[model samples]
Target: MSLFHFSIRIKSSRLCLLNIKVYFCFALAICLLGIKAEVRANDRYEIVINTGVSEKALSVNSLRSIFSMHLKTWSDGTKIRVFVFSDDDQLHQNFSKEKLNVFPYQLRSTWDRLVYSGTGQAPIKVNSTEEMLTKVATTPGAIGYLWRADINEKVNVLEIK
Candidate 1:
């Protein structure tokens, strides 16, 4: 009877340890999920360009010129081609207002006029930052904007002042 009681006590202790471990694992999982959700919430924009781009820091005016097709090349002789996110995207609205100093609607109307008049082509609109980054990375002379968190080794970042 004594031996049996000892064995039962050991089993109960083991069960208690197992329960503690399970609770620890559950808590850890919840913490990790919270961290991931917070990371996803802090959205920021990035300026991405082709590998060969020379201009590292561009003024708002210069960026505007490049996107508006007023400037065609860098000082190093690389041709410039700009890409833009769709009008509905937050990045597009923020970039237009903050960097381009224009409202999203006004910018779209101006781009349309430029396209229709044959004066300049509108920047190619991409659906997402990931798509923009992939295309800009692969295509020579391509430049686009994306969320900063989405930037990766595939594309080079340019500073917009």
Candidate 2:
């Protein structure tokens, strides 16, 4: 081939390789973002309660008892006000199923029944973990759960059994 044709071919090949590399990098970035999103989605949480209330470590049963009004007062006689995340939230769903050993729908139905019957009041619902933490911190006799990563100094995190 002539010199000019050979140079053109080299430049064209280099451009094609560069385009392929860019596309590959873009695809890799997208995959990494997707993986990060999924990890965030399934992030686990630790249950936390107010300080100086119960020396007894919390468990699913204890949590249920407190939430369902079976256990109205803490060991110290502090009336418990349970704070809960929204029923439709994914984190709430996972936490309920994994930690609470109950489904969101079941919890909702239970709350509804309690509200309707005037037997007990359901826990106050917060839209997000941050809000739950904030409300739990500011409000006395409050208890709630949130993602471990979402915890901050605003609230006291109680150890669960």
Candidate 3:
């Protein structure tokens, strides 16, 4: 082949490689941004309660007490019924750690102690997100945690201090 043609071919291949690099860099940047947003999504959970309850927010400690079944009644004298997912559930783990600053095992230990001691009761365990939403909606003064996306008009999102 002529030297001229050979040089042109080399240039074209170099251009193609450069294009691939640029494309990949753009893709990598987009992926990084998406990962940041996904992390925020992972943290998106809300403390929800039945609308009949008057309180709109709670301190983290009070929230912990409620979930641990030590706080049995809402301030308005409405019975505070607590709901939860099973200990092994991912949502349960996240909520326990992030919101309550406790592990699932710790919450479980507290609940078990409450139950066996006969002075208190454990929270109701819901099987799925749907069951959680339904129970919290139907039961007055009920409290539970749910992913923000699954939340609807049936319950009020309780703010945590």
Candidate 4:
């Protein structure tokens, strides 16, 4: 090949390599985003109770009853004070849907019916996750939901069987 053609071929080869590098970087970014999303999706919340409480594990049905205000006390007869975030809160909504198998609105309806009918009371609503963690960690007989990242050593995570 002539000198000019050789130089041209080298430039084209370099350009092709550069294009491949760009495509590879783009694919890597997409893969990383997918991985991040998967990890985030799996980072779910846990049902937490005060450290002083007696229970270590609870059945899903019983947990539902507690949040629904049907079960008022623990098995040991201590008053179970349930704490929750606002109905629209994402963590609260996820906990209600995933753990209780009910939507947040459904939980509100149940609490409202009980409260208005003079059968039971609603949960104590907090403003933020920080408040939730603090209240549940400090108060005796307190039960609430918290994101796994927000959980601290002061609170006990209740296992739902």
lDDT of 2 by residue, 45-100 (tens): 76766554545477668887776656778777878888887887777777777667
lDDT of each candidate versus the true structure? 0.80, 0.76, 0.88, 0.89
Clashing pairs in 3: none
lDDT score, candidate 3, position 121: 92
Per-residue lDDT tens digits of candidate 3, residues 6-93?
9999999999999999999999999988752113444688999999899998998899888888888888877999999989887887
- 10 residues in a row with least lDDT, candidate 4: 34-43
Best by lDDT: 4
Candidate 4, superposed: residue stretches over 4 Å from native? 1-43
Q: TM-score per candidate, in order?
A: 0.68, 0.67, 0.73, 0.73
Indicate the TM-score of model 4.
Answer: 0.73
Q: Which stretches of candidate 2 lie over 4 Å from their true place?
A: 1-43, 52-56
Q: Candidate 3, overall lDDT? A: 0.88
Q: Residue 3 of candidate 3: its Cα lDDT?
A: 95
Candidate 1 accuracy as TM-score = 0.68
